[model samples]
Target: MPIKAQMEQLQRVTSLSVALEWVTGCPDLAGRDTVLKLIGEEVSTTIQGVIYSAESKGGGGAEMA
Candidate 1:
């Protein structure tokens, strides 16, 4: 499959949790699966860090008048 298809399916079929679970299930995965897993982890970790910082900072800098 192509990267285009993978991105589309990411929203529809696997979801982040399912992809992470798939990654954990295999230690020697390769190809598209590895690419998808890497992307997922990268996004997940980044989002987590953002949320943590926001909580620590209180209102996360999103305050509105």
Candidate 2:
């Protein structure tokens, strides 16, 4: 997928794991190492963000956006 399209998708997806699973299982995307690597990096970054947000939530009032 093109970067423009990817950016659009990034705005909508709520779960990187599920997106990764879908990408990995995609017939058109099979055997593409670069795409897999990009997906992994995205997932890792997203997970870190979630972890930090959870840990730093103030006054128990913070919720996922």
Candidate 3:
């Protein structure tokens, strides 16, 4: 599957294991690296609350936001 389509599938799934499975099942190492990079960027943005800034709760004693 194309990486974009694979990533869409990964987003629809709720489990990290399932996402990992998608990555591992990729036939091309370069494709896996690209997908992993995208995932990492998404994860980092989520962790920093940059993706959810509109709903940010003002840190609330947490490091996010």
Q: Best by TM-score, which number?
A: 3
What is the number of backbone collisions in each predicted candidate, taken in the order shown?
Answer: 0, 0, 0
lDDT of 3 by residue, 4-50 (tens): 64455455444544677789889999999998887777666544443
Candidate 1 regions exceeding 4 Å error are 1-30, 59-65
lDDT of each: 0.57, 0.58, 0.59
Q: Pairing residues by index, what is the TM-score of model 3? A: 0.49
lDDT of 2 by residue, 3-60 (tens): 4544555553456556666667667644556667876788667555545545566434
Candidate 3 wrong stretches, greater than 4 Å? 1-17, 50-65
Residue pair clashes in candidate 2? none
Residue 63, model 2: Cα distance from true site in angstroms: 15
In angstroms, what RMSD does candidate 1 have relative to the true structure?
Answer: 9.9
**Candidate 1 clashing pairs?**
none
Q: TM-score for each prediction?
A: 0.45, 0.46, 0.49
Per-candidate Cα RMSD to the true structure, in Å, reads 9.9, 8.3, 9.3
Worst 10 residues of 3 by lDDT: 50-59
